[model samples]
Target: MRDYPNDQNLQDLQERYHLFAHMDAAIIDAERDKACPEGPLQDLVVGLKANIASIGANWSAGLRHRIAITAQSDAHLTKRLRDHGARILPGLNMDAAALGGGTDNPDLGRTANPHAPDHSAGGSSGGSAAAVATGLCDVAIGTDTLGSIRIPASYCGVFGLKPTFGLIGRSGIVPLAPSLDTVGILTARAGDVWPVLQALAGPDGGDTDSQPAPAQWANQTATPDAQGLRIGIPQQVSTVECTPETLVALASARTTLEQAGAHVETIDMPEWNPAKLRQKAFLMTEAEGAATFAEALGTAGTLPRTVERLLTYGSTLSAAKLVAGMAEIRAARVQLARSFAQVDVLLMPTTPQRAFQADAPAPANQADFTALANAGGVPALAVPIEVAGQALPASVQLVGPAWSEPRLIRLAMVLESAF
Candidate 1:
């Protein structure tokens, strides 16, 4: 096992940035005993979102009262990583109960953007992104339920991948929205994503959501070339109000893909409405979250007021309304599948704006562009785009049909090379 002689420095950074929910030498020591010396992730350090369980560390899922509860066993993905040689760090902080877009936890603390200390790190998975950006860890595991992983990746200028739903096991992850929650990775380098993904993805009996690798994924031997790939930019993207920098970054990415011989065009996907889909997805999250934390909702200090309010609203949703919302989301997924028939990938900005000030009000439209992938249970990769004269990096995402993670990552590499 690799030794962590700089544990003090790690702790100092965690305190400075509020990156971890719990970081102790005892936790690291326990993980070291389980590390594999001959695996793919050997010597790599990884931090996990608070929701993912790791034995000997707290597994509160960012709730204030559950902070004292320790995980009895490693999460399926955590075990896979340890078996593949990754040195697991303590659990990272997150939005309280994973309800908000900003990582301002009323209990633990706010996770500040490493790129700009005054700015916000996008939510739920914000700590995971910040840890990777600040070099606190080589890789971080995050759970994405409606843009959680990609938003933070965009804001923090790191690479984030929300793999095809069920591609990665969710056995030990705390549920927010079972239909939307997906375990994914965030890393400093685009290349690091695949190796870690390879280590953690596969069928898991413990997780009902897990599935066997598709033939295309298992037999994949070479990275796909950008030449002649069909790239589509949805017409709805024009309807969203994006910052000038974000728009420019999207345009530049189009030009880069075009130069690489890819066929880039604007495609009309009338059935796909990002705003409507996001609302539907949020309802599902809140409703499902209420059920997941039913017992805690009765306790006084187990959850924050905002989370309690959201869950209460979800609990009040009529059964018919919930069914209607699920139907609409399913319809949206069908529309997305049909669109994929015409294009290999869909390109769009990860978020409409760059990272806002930590103290600023969180934008309601943060997930407008990102919820489509989650609703459709597809793979989406977010990569930072460097825009000249801009203080923060703008980001673009590539979304594809289910099990298309390999293509998305290869395309991201091509896009990464351009900037």
Candidate 2:
């Protein structure tokens, strides 16, 4: 059987793409040695976001200076990928500490968009998304608290899936917002998303949020659940300010799905405003982030400005405000679920627009659409669809209720065909 070191395709991809932060020969070879050729993911090259720890690899999550830290042991996700026959390529660049949406890292260098190097690779997992889209690796492991995985997938023109909050284990990954953190997959080829997910979906001993592992991998590529699948487009999403290009892409994709025999309908979800939803997400993220970085709080100047700024703000938030935000989010989640109760899945634009320039500040509403899934603790699938003749990638998100990964994947297959 073809293996990582022996596969001509893998060798070719490595030569053509400069996507890794630390692609050490020894670390990769060591992982390759542990791969099971007989496993489901034979011959696959997997990129690990720098934050996802890997034994013996440089473990800094894109820090300005090299810290003398290495992942003395493989993270749960890392071990799972290798055990399932993937050659783990660790240390890909990310927004320093996975703090923001754009994949611009100072310590590890900014990741170039595979489709447009001059543009941003919607980030935090920017390196992983670029690596897959550029063919550097077959798939990548990325962590998403907000839209980290999906935004980059939309920007890079690939597929990214953020399963339900507690579905995938988050044991060794560096925390951005522990309460919202979710580890997920990014794939070059849509067909492989399920198989890779099959190998990795499960609870970890250490992840406090870990719930019952999913048993629906078979359904990832299977037909929708027992009932007829219903796809919903929220009314609020329609009113959000978005680029004309995104509006066009959303219309095009929706039309295609409807034509493909799926029941597509618009549902009212007044509580789900993109910007307000983001603010609530920010409040929750900051509060948890401040606690996560409590050790670094004492030596604030040493931290990155963005990290420090967010942490500082998070530290000072009035307890009543945080409490109010949490209550509001909880109500929003319940309200969002009621919207889902009418449909088996929900559809929305993954980002407000296609990839932005590297220098352009991210659209304040960039994660507006995608963060709904993260905030609600539901599953979301971001599929890149070709908007006829457009060179830039346009993508849409498919969201489902918590633990509805199977249904979400089923819907993703439809978008995959339409794209």
Candidate 3:
């Protein structure tokens, strides 16, 4: 069994980084009793985002007023992890109500990037990625709604997998956008993602969004050959104003995949405008989030002003605007599906830049490349790129069709081995 981090080290790290929103001996003990000695994850320690439900732990979802709300039962995925022998930690910190890209919460404070203390750990799932990056936990579970998981994973230089939509059950997870919220895994190494994914993925009767595994995935192997793989790079990616380092990292990835016998081509996606689509996704999230948290909003002082303002805007959106946003999102999904017909996978930069200062205002385009996957209901894997002279890590993502996690993971492994 892998050893847990020493208590002193764990406490010091948490103090310095503000990694957890709620954690204590009680939370640990509650999870310990559920561990199965002979299970596959018997030795693993897992951390969950504040929004994911774990019985006996606080489920604040980063809201100060909601801090008293404790989960009455384990979420479907949490139960599976315990059954597989993993010990759950208390909830990690996140952006207020999971509405932002940076993990600076008005209630929970900020999660510092393990790689660089002054920099932001990418959001909603920032605490999850930081825990894995700093060895506080072997794996961390996070919710991704428009790059929440992958963004922090990139900033922290960890492997984050946002599996195909509906591939993982979402019961007990606080809903951000019911249509886009997905539970995903983050780990220090790429190899760790597959096993954990295998253990937690399956249909849950309680989660209406849960999907059954297709027959072809039953016996599918994680080892996928790169030869003859068709890789597509959307033409719009080249036009995006990425930092020089980010662009270099992306070029390196393209070259590496090509050298590995994967056929790389630039393809046109005329209907997909990342910046515009991202706005549409934001609107959907806000509108859906407003509906989900309607009751909470009525109680003044229950949430921060920023969160209240965003949700209020969402609540007041005209029916015509909401319908238009939904229509745009549907079009994005169709555009992505059509792109998939020509390539086995779409490769692009995960974020347009590296980790910025925690105190800095988040860029508006952070989710440009990632939101489409959510809108399209596809799977995406974000892996850190090691640039020769750069101190901060750059990252890229591989997007595939719905239920194509195995293929995306396999290809990610190839890139992992090469890096």
TM-score of each: 0.96, 0.92, 0.97
* Model 3, span 259-341: residue lDDT tens: 88899999999888999889988998989999998998888777789989999999999989888888888988888889989
Residues 1-419 of candidate 1 have per-residue lDDT tens digits of 22442768777887789898767677776665664577878878888999999887899888888888888998999889888878887688799877888889988889999988899999989999999988878999999999999999999999999998898998987889888898999998887788888888888888888887776575553253688899999999988889999999999999999998899999999987888888888999999988988898888666899999999889889999899789879988999989999999999999999999999998989999889999899999999999898779999999999988878888888888888
Q: Give per-residue CA lDDT, model 2, range 1-419, as digits (tens).
A: 22354445544544444465555677766766773556888768888999888989988776654446789898988888878877877888788778888877655667778787788888889889988887667889999988999999999999899987877788888887888889999987666777887788776998988887546444545443323557888888767788787878788778877776777888988777777878888888888888877777668576788778888899899989898778767877987778877988888899989999889898888888888888888889898888677789888898888777766666666667666
User: What is candidate 2's CA lDDT for residue 311?
Assistant: 82
Model 1 global lDDT (CA atoms, 0 to 1): 0.88
Candidate 3 is scored at a TM of 0.97
The true-versus-predicted C-alpha distance at residue 93 of model 3, in Å, is: 1.2
Candidate 2 lDDT for residue 235: 85
Please state every model's RMSD to the true fold in angstroms: 1.7, 2.7, 1.4
Number of clashing pairs per prediction, in order:
0, 0, 0
